[model samples]
Target: MLKDLSPQAFFMGLLTAFVGFASSFAVVLQGLKGVGASDAQAASGLMALSISMGLCAIVLSFSTRLPVSIAWSTPGAALLVSAGAAVGGFNAAVGAFIVCAILIVIAGLFKPLGRAVAAIPAPLANAMLAGVLVGLCYAPVKAVSFNPAFGLPIVLAWLVVGAWKRLYAVPAALIAFAGVLAFGVDIPEGAFASWAQSLGPTVLLVKPEFHLASIVSIGLPLFIVTMASQNIPGIAVLKVNQYEPNPGPLFATTGLFSLFSAPFGGHAVNLAAITAAMCAGEDAHPDPARRYWAAVIAGIGYVVFGLLAGAVTGFVALAPPVLIQAVAGLALVGAFSGSAFAALKEPETREAAAVTFIVTASGVTFAGISGAFWGLLAGGLAMGLARVARR
Candidate 1:
């Protein structure tokens, strides 16, 4: 099956899968902790994410014949960890998931809000995206501080590949991984060995209880963040690539998936920007008809990894923290730059976008929600009010 694919298509798919796998490791760990999951449960959550996103990617790819890679909702995952830690534990988190699903279904059904989000000015939407990505860059930079030995090599790999203009199209991450191996970095002896030891998995089938508090705290916030931060920009990415998937179904499907998987500790699911970009690019498949296989491969990878959640967690834990951080930051550089440029491009929107960028990057939380959502809301409102006054 792989042999018929062009070299670019094959490599793009491979790169998308690798990035999708690595990017979610830390956030998954946080999700497990939110629900007070044991080591095994925590690992299972990671596996669940891998499986859900992987399967989604595969189905969407093959069906659409586009390089549409699905990924665990990064914002949703981060929110889950943060909110789940604060609220009534896993039960509350589950409540949030249900609420998010309801909201998504409504959005799909309503038509107006879905269209509004899709219709947001491209510059403004991109500005909001840049604001959202501000913090993501820190992960890799911080990773360097945590484990310089491992982190340094990864950074060097990015630099080397970046400097070598000839290999510009080669995945910087693949190069980074090779650099890490070349450095002869010591892998913990027990890291690989632990795969053989099975901790009798305890699966908690959470019966989601509806609580007003949980709904307000988790559900409402998750819906907002997922929509504002993840889904909106996701649609933008698709549009940017000229794929133009129907936003209603796409949003509805992701929400439905999250609703079903929340009890199993799966965070939000949405379209993947960076990974999707890999397959959507001209380099991936010029013909466009063949690019979808990359996503199919990704979805298959997710399901396989999710079943082995324990092993996935162990593997992540075993890797040097710096390495994880470095890889994350490097991977997000393009996103960060894109966001910043978007935020500053328009003379009229600059101030509001700047405010959004600052507030979001500050990482402040109020009323049980993170700064990203609030930042965008506040900035957008400010811009709106200013326009009204001038008019």
Candidate 2:
């Protein structure tokens, strides 16, 4: 197996990890904080997610000899941002994460359940995702209003870099945000010393507290988005590159890892979508069979990066809240645009999709259920009535 490894594969693996970790970690932090996680807890969640997904990728890729990348569900984190804190706060959110992970496992183990989830209309799913992301998408603009001196640079960095090389855009914004934090924002004395002190990896277990409202509001929607936005696309990316691993086992493995990480405040770890391309593509290696090495190496990179979560979280926390949010918003713009475009593409479902998007963007909460659930329900009803009318 060592004979199969190449320098190109190694480089691509490290690049995959860098891009994956740098791109949307702020979203993970923000989402954890949104769900009532203290800074220490959010740091723990980030570390847990990073390590879990890293290990997951290593195990799957090494065992199957496929470039199976793994990642936290960025969309699920965004959903948490919109869903707000659950009735029982962060512990309840942890319980919801466990429920979502278990659902993924069940879907993987039971073909019927998997098929049922797969049968959800793509337009509705995409619309719901689009809705959840709309608020965050506005962060870049809002950041500018909060302080153009600080935020403009971040937005411009993303725009200029994205126009040149779309893949590096978010990381560029992340760098710009870092610069703003270091030079533009004033940090309290000794904060750097404290952050340095907290540089090492640490885990904090959050005892789960299950509540019906949390399960309905956060868990179900989280499961849906993770499957639709990340897991399915990850499988498709592998297939696109001519690797056909059984989707069931991969899903189950990711779910198990996610389950393990949940008590540490991690939301969901699943097959990666964007980073999957990096490890699975020709850039990783010319020989398709050898690409798995890239994924394995990337897994190692993620673990190393995970160790720094405490420092990263601490540094970002010192900046104005809007600044980190701007970076996260920049990271998600591509996803939001893609989902919105896909959701509205089919003429037959366009209206229903629109309805779903509107309801989700409204951020409505009814009977302790989030807009995501209600939006899906409303869109499903709209499509059902349309079908009946056509009949």
Candidate 3:
């Protein structure tokens, strides 16, 4: 079945995995801060999430006979970074995880929330997505300015693959990486060569401690952000790709996974958009029935990468900052354009979408929650009120 797919499809899947992994490296630091995790504990969290996501993707793909990619909730990480700082360190963050898990479980059982979100107008959803992705595009351009030597190669690679659309799925990230090596980018001296580093490592695990203050301060906000920012768009991605897996099961699985890993400082887990798109694309497998393997492959790769957390961290540390920025920026360009275009498509909704985009892009925060949540709420409410007045 894998052999039957075009090379482009397989390469696309590989690219998807690479991008997902690379983009997520920054979150490790945030995750550590949220949980007050020791280096080993942090590594464990990374490993566990990767393994869970990979296993879930593999099982779901095989069971559903459709390509399905599962990924750690990126928005969840961002939410944690903001809210975790205020909470009582890692323990409080774990408490929030527990709350989010329970909420997800309840959401799965109820079905109404999922149904309503699914009912959202495509244009509105797209506008919200555009707003979400706009900030991401700036990273790469910024990276290039910071480190021209490293960033240039990544940009060149992007241009090369972009120009030759036939090589679109050829893991442009790998090419960029090659450019990094070819350019002789230097790493900071003695970054990790310290006696503090222990060779024989004991896996550290965290126990969830519930506190009222922490739950209100951290848990509630994280839960709201994860649902509003991540899961809603995740469902939209699945729908847009025309793969209608049962939302209940998907939500339930992610919730359960989060529940299991929360004590160890893992954040919310959910579907991936960009990575999933790779698997869902016609390039992966013309016969959609077989495309699930691509996700399965990606999931497995995620686990492998996760286990190498130390190595991953070291590599990212050595990587020129400009390169990171450039890669992130390039990757987000399509997403940003698609989102902005969607946000303005409807005359009636244009004003609301614009409001959402501006507010979200402005990066405002109230009580630890990000502008993305408020922007969507503000826009959605305005649209709803306007419709009501029309009636």
Candidate 4:
């Protein structure tokens, strides 16, 4: 297996891990805080998610010999941010997360459920994912308006690198973001010592407290959004790249990992959608057969990044939130573009796709559930009506 390793694959793996962490890990941290996680609990969540997904990726890649990337559910995290606090606070939210995980596992183990998940119309799923990305994708333009000096450089870096090679664009923007942070702002000489000291994850646990409200609102919707938005798109990406790993086992393994992680304040973990392209695509390696190394290396990278989760939190705390957001936004544009294209690619699904995208982007809240859920519901309803009208 190691014989397949190449320099191209190695750096690509490194790049994948770098972009993956820098893109939305901050959002993950914020999501934990929204659920009323104490600072320590939030740290524990980051560490747990990082380690869990890392191990998941490593094992899946090696076992299946496929680049089966795993990631914390970004949309689910967003859902937690919106409704978790309202649904009985942190412990209840933890229970909701566990419930979501368990549901994912059941969905995996049960063939009919697996078929049902797979049966979700691709357009609606794409539209829902696009909607989720819209808020994030707009961040760069928003950031530049807020701070041209800081944000413009990142934008320019992204544009230039994107023109050269699309895959490298986000990483280039990240470097530019870091450069701006490093030189544009002054750092105390002594703080470096403090920064050094705060590396590696600290363990903390939240005892879960389940409630019907939390289950109906946060758990069910979280599972639906994660499956619809992340896993479905993830499988599509792998298929496009000529890799087809079994879906049932993928879902089951990630769900189990997520279940294990919940008590430690981690949210959902699942098949990766966006960064899956980075590791699975031709850019990761010339020989498609050997791309598994990229994912394996990425797994190692995620673990290493997990060790620095504490430091990453501190670094984000030090920077302007808008700046971090700007960088994060830069990273997600590619995903938004792909999802949007997929949503609207077919003429028949256009109306339903538009409905999904608008509702999701609107961020409307009702019945203690998030717009991602409502968006999909609205889109599906629209689709059904359109079919009836046709009949």
* Model 4 Cα lDDT, one tens digit per residue, 1-391: 8898998888988888877777678678767887788767887889889889989999999999888888889877755655547467899989989999998999989989877877888898888877876776677888789889888998999999999987678778878888888888667677767766667676788889998877876787788778988887788889999987788889999999999889999989999987899889898887888998888888899988887888877676566777777766676677678879989999998999999989978887787776777888999999999999999
Task: Provide TM-scores for the models.
Answer: 0.77, 0.99, 0.75, 0.87
Clashes of each: 9, 0, 9, 0
Q: Candidates sorted by TM-score, descending order?
A: 2, 4, 1, 3
The candidate maximizing TM-score is 2
Q: Model 1, which residues run further than 4 Å from truth?
A: 1-12, 30-39, 62-67, 78-84, 119-132, 162-195, 198-225, 228-244, 281-286, 319-323
Model 4 misses residue 190 by how many Å?
Answer: 7.4
Where is the poorest 10-residue window by lDDT in model 2?
A: 194-203
Runs in model 4 deviating more than 4 A are 1-12, 78-84, 186-196, 240-244, 277-291
Candidate 1 residue 112 C-alpha distance from true site, Å: 1.7
Q: Rate the local accuracy (lDDT) of all candidates.
A: 0.64, 0.94, 0.64, 0.82
TM-score comparison, 2 vs 3, better candidate: 2
Ranking by lDDT: 2, 4, 1, 3
Please report the candidate that would top lDDT against the real structure. Answer: 2
Candidate 1, 296-368: lDDT as tens digits: 7667766765666665565555555555545555655665686578668898888778777676666666765
Worst 10-residue lDDT window for candidate 4 reads 78-87
List residue ranges in candidate 3 displaced over 4 A: 1-45, 75-86, 119-132, 166-186, 192-244, 277-290, 320-323
Give the clashing residue pairs of candidate 4, or none. none
